[model samples]
Target: MTRSEVRTVLLDAVRELRPEFAGLRLTGNEHLGAELGLDSVARVELLVVLEEEFGIEDEVDPRIFMTPATVNALVDQIVVAEGVCR
Candidate 1:
């Protein structure tokens, strides 16, 4: 999938998981944890949603959630994990 497509999917999943974020214009730069206020639980939920949305079954690396993460970074990770060529 293209970056724009990945961004759209990520935004949709994030909105579903966090309705408050629905109004925010999510640039790829927004930090998933710090800026978006996603706690550990929310991050996990987001990852689960992303995995389900993309039909990804492989276990995600826990380290990815250990620190602040950005939308672009997460999308890149998902695209790689899903084995979708850019």
Candidate 2:
């Protein structure tokens, strides 16, 4: 997978996992909670889903998941670190 692919996957996963957040156009740097009306539980759920979906472990910094751009950047970093992408 490439960076764009990772972004697409994350975008789709986010949209699917949080139907209440559906229809909100997410862009890089958008606040995941305030912008999407997500509570702490939903945020944690998203983190878990993202970890499982991407096969990432706990090394991911908690702060990096705060925003869509940061999340995408973190995923890209993990993909590169794990050699999951070219």
Candidate 3:
């Protein structure tokens, strides 16, 4: 998927986990953990949601998506993973 497509999917996943961010705009630079206030638990939850959404749970490592990073960076990772995913 294109990065924009990945971003849309990521945004949806994040909104699903934290409804409060539904209206917020992600500039792709905001820190997932710090700016978004996604703690470890939330990050893990996000990971699960992302894996399910991307259908790459077995193809990619969950831990890779769990790291604290920007939404854009995560989108890059997801794009790469999906490109090579089963």
Cα lDDT tens digits for candidate 1, 1-86: 47677578767777777788888787768888777777788777766765676676455564564454887887677556545536
- Error in Å for residue 24 of model 2: 6.4
For model 3, the stretches where C-alpha displacement exceeds 4 angstroms are 80-86
lDDT computed for candidate 1: 0.69
Report the poorest 10 consecutive residues by lDDT, candidate 2.
Answer: 62-71
- lDDT per residue for candidate 2 within 1-86, as digits (tens), equals 46676666666666876786578776634555555555656556665766676676574454545543344555655565556555
Candidate 1 residue pairs that clash:
none
> Candidate 2: lDDT of 55?
79
Ranking according to lDDT, highest score first: 3, 1, 2
Q: Return the candidate ranking by TM-score, descending.
A: 3, 1, 2
Question: By the lDDT metric, which is better: model 2 or model 3?
Answer: 3
Which stretches of model 1 miss by more than 4 angstroms? 78-85
Off by over 4 Å in 2: 21-25, 67-86
Residue 3, model 3: Cα distance from true site in angstroms: 2.8
Cα deviation at 27, candidate 2, in Å, is: 3.9
RMSD of 2: 4.0
What lDDT does each candidate get?
0.69, 0.59, 0.70
